[model samples]
Target: MQKVCWPYFDPDFENLRERIYGPTCRVSIDNESMEDCTVIKVDSVNKQGLLLEMVQVLTDMNLSISKSYISSDGGWNMDVFHVKDEHGNKIRDQRVIDYIQQAIDTTRETLSSSSLSSPKAKAKVYTNSTLLSSDHYNEHTAIEMTGTDRPGLFSEISAALADLHCNIIKVHAWSHNTRLACVAYVSDQRTDTPIEDRSRLATIEDHLTMVLRAQPTTGSQRATPPNQQEVKASDLQGGEGTMTNVERRLHQLMLSVRDFDEPASESSSSPMMPMGLGPDRNGQNPRISIEEWNEKGYSAVNIKCKDRRRLMFDTVCTLTDMQYVIFHASACARAGYAYQEYFIRHIDGSALSTEGEKERVMKCLEAAIERRVCEGFRLELCANNRIGLLSDITRVLRENGLAVVRADVETQGEKAVNAFYLKDISGNEVDMEFVERIKREMGPIMLAVKDETRRQSSSEKPTMPFPSLGGFLKSRIERLSHNFVTIK
Candidate 1:
């Protein structure tokens, strides 16, 4: 019998290895790999939430990940992503490539500097504006609200802010499962500065809570009691009060309120479930499955749904916030559908063990994906920013019998660039005549109808089989081995 020699483990050797390779982050972009997309390769020292940081960077740039392979183990991470622009063309712009490189480099530096901190501290550093340039949470007051959603809820909320002498600088709102979550950035209307008066902030919060508590007559039944409605106001000035990304905050708020729970009256005919191209060609809704991988000590999550922009970001963000760590994952978009698989374990290194936990995960993932669905016509408005601009616009929408399913409001310099996904009050398609009349009434607002069909058409191309988990893992291993051989 041959004797087997076991390698000795040394603490000093481990410390030396950390010193040698801990701060290394190498990102290479290959535009010539495949004819359809750009291949991005990243190798770095692994840490919690690193995958999410990278994915957020790419998705924020409006880039689509057509395919990707992720691996993070043994204090190192390596990932390869096949990405394309929104136009379904290979990335040929040098400026965009350089921007991605810079963003990744900045991420690496931030992580390195915060290496000694807790995982939560590192997450805060990455989520701050150090890696992504955002003006939404700067020099403004942020108002967060979660309650039952209704048709004219936003109109009333905006009116309350306007009455409080607060100007809406930007707002992001989402509705799902008969619940609404929104974050509105507002400044003092007269001073154009953050709202600092505690009394006034209290008044604003109280007034909005009343509006949210007001029941809707023609939508899904209100499940939560009026007294339980939540409204929070805080100054988002520089320093310790900085908030995370508005969308992520919205997700957190919704999850905190347990929006994933299916209401008793929820149905396909509910106004909250606006009909459109949300379902795939086969008329299938988002399918999510979670199974235990006992061999690997991880829970495998698989999701299949209609592909859309920022899909990966939404899923990964939800998982990270839920205290799950993704160890290996694969994502691919073929035809009009997205297929994603993730092997994840709790932060405590335990796989999901209960059926109830699996059900909750599935529901949460489904809700996250549905929150960002483009359900109605996208109306974009670009005009000069003014004290009551958002209020005026939303009032027009409400008066015209249109309801905003989703909205993105932003201010660039003196310009208020806002986009709203609009449907009729009954959740039916909006009348084009109404849109035309509103365009004429709102003079100089520069309202235009975006071509939603173009996006749908882009996904209607050729189809391909989604790679199975076994095949994906095999290919990933082969690719990693090839890289190791080249390095040696």
Candidate 2:
């Protein structure tokens, strides 16, 4: 069987470099008709992960999204959201909107500037005027890529585009015949406009071609027969996890920051008992043990498990997300075993001295490791953009007791494409019954959104596109008050 590769996750710094910045962005918040809710409207150049980032910012600000609509036509993106602060009040502050606009604008500026300084600029370029004809320059720059499918391929392509200062407007990807094919519509990041510079366009194309052609040293590549597979140079160490060749090199480079003068003694080594966690599921047990060094004022964390592609990313991302700071770390993989150790402190510069905190950290790490090892069922859907579409889909999943492990949603033209990786709330495979129930609930909601959109456009007198599903749900909920008088 072909080995499936996990998705690639770049360090936080790399995420900034990969961010797509729109040339023009406008944000406005108003509260006229909605009660205790603010309506936010945004128009900008569409890019990958843009919506999610916006959502994150709002979430961080303690705002709840009551309803939302997102649409992208070619390069332009439009989004409307109804939100309320934690206190259940509309945000009437102009300064808040200004802050959001400024944040997005700064991101765009950074993306544009970073692309102009890509390392690929130093590489040899072949002139291809035909690819940049006037007609092509006026239209969206179309990028078509084909290569052996592997985990993290999408991330690589996205990184290349970001480096080249290309703003992806639309994307369609599929895997077939053990190969991947992807086509994207992109625009010039600096102008939020079409590609007019033939030389620049040619350079972008060349850079992407090179990226696609380059073989990834990650184990995500189709696994060869045991006898035919050649041992990689970095995997010579008998360590527990699978590290890509690039990751291996990067890991070594990062380890240079560790203080080598620290007292090195075998006495501190942990002797953890075997923990049977997901052994039958993924053929590996994720074990994490924490040891505190009172003299050093830091905690030592040791992790051992079967190495898989992007294992390092999964571990690091979990640690960072949990607000842990790694003062020092080492990782190695050999003979299908991966081992990782970290000297860490909390974000507040405290060690994990509490048993509760240590247990929480271990549990989170185990969950992250399991996710990387065994993925959930992924379903992709594309439909016309509609208000409250996301909310409706999520509600259906909730009602069906389905847990969404991961989701990515983007819009192109008038259609919205969404991919969801699903698991049962009980942490089991989603059976056919659950899948059918979701479909049954989703079918009407989708049709209602589409119907509402059509009606609003055709009617001269503008009407509300669709009633908020939240409202209906609220009405269905019964209220019992102690002061209420019973009437016969």
Candidate 3:
């Protein structure tokens, strides 16, 4: 059970009172539900990344997801999953089940705390920026954007595209020194054509400009500016609600570079290369090198690897998960390879202080880079969008013993064109026979999703929450003030 602080009586007491009485999330595992698996069911309020968090917890518990059904009605979320222990049997240990429940309960407590007390930042206005035009080839129209980096940046841009009815095809984004640069290839979803309307393009640009300069609606930590401005008292008092677990985790992990105002006591004059790791002379494999700038109080990491979709996202995700706060970073691809450099320190505002720490980090990074370069299978799936489709697909992948190294999931014009880069459980290449087996197993499931979509369209009445600009604006504001999710 989560601890409660019941010391004071004020208007804020309502929040505490509610927490004390909030609906308790029920998590239970039934060992006899399936022939050889356990069924775990969870009933709770939904939030962004909730499914992912569940999957992570299960994975950590040595359980493999075989099947899942996720649905949300009104505001409540009901999720059920069929899973097996590492030995491919039903989980019968009461202690393990209790542990799993506790982990999930902790996730909810963290979510609630963040939503109740997250800070609000003031919004800034930005000048209108010109949208990019296509060249002679005209493959796709691009929207090139550069802005101050902040939490929920991706979600904000996605919301803007959805509002404009622009379909995103592909996106490449990079961040460095508190700035983000993104280029999105997009189309008009309704027309299925390149965005040609000048007014519409202008509106798209305007919306993104507003989003770029806007205060973060999600409770992710605000990116500290160079001056390390303190949060205003009013901002703390008037926090927006409905923060996600991911945002809160990020807020806890990230320490803005500007917070480090002290000079380093020691500095390295030469670049530090990995002692036992190096790229082949033929340049067939990825390479990683780490150098500590002790005087500057951070480490400089350099990576050279094959460029692939979602590579940047994966790299950032790994660093963030490892509790490294990036102070400056840059990446660029050329000649079929990517070169990335990062200056980073520990989350606690300490440098990699010891040889052991440096060595461990270097080894972990090397393994990560190698896993990306390892031989893998790629599968592309396209279908009309359906609720919980991604969750289903991810569960299928896990059930097949395939680890997803990278994935790009985007929906355009109500159609989702997704890509998955996968490898076997041992991080080795999968054979063609295994690939065929995956396709054969997933074929029916994919077909079923499509059939379900058609059936729903034929039998159910459609309703729009916002049918006019007034309602749309109101809904947008409410969403922004609460939990804002990316449209995809």
CA-lDDT, candidates in order: 0.69, 0.49, 0.51
In order of appearance, the predictions have TM-scores of 0.77, 0.30, 0.29
Q: Estimate the overall C-alpha local distance difference test score of candidate 1.
A: 0.69
Worst 10 residues of 1 by lDDT: 123-132
Q: Is candidate 1 or candidate 3 better by TM-score?
A: 1
Q: Write the per-residue lDDT of candidate 2 for residues 235-258, one digit (tens) a residue.
A: 111011112221222222212111
The model with the greater lDDT, 2 or 3, is 3
User: Order the candidates by lDDT, highest first — what do you get?
Assistant: 1, 3, 2
Off by over 4 Å in 3: 1-285, 294-298, 309-313, 320-332, 347-349, 367-375, 384-488
**What would the TM-score be for candidate 3 when compared with the true structure?**
0.29
TM-score of 1: 0.77
- What is the lDDT, from 0 to 100, of the residue 434 in candidate 1? 39
CA shift at 75, candidate 3, in angstroms? 43
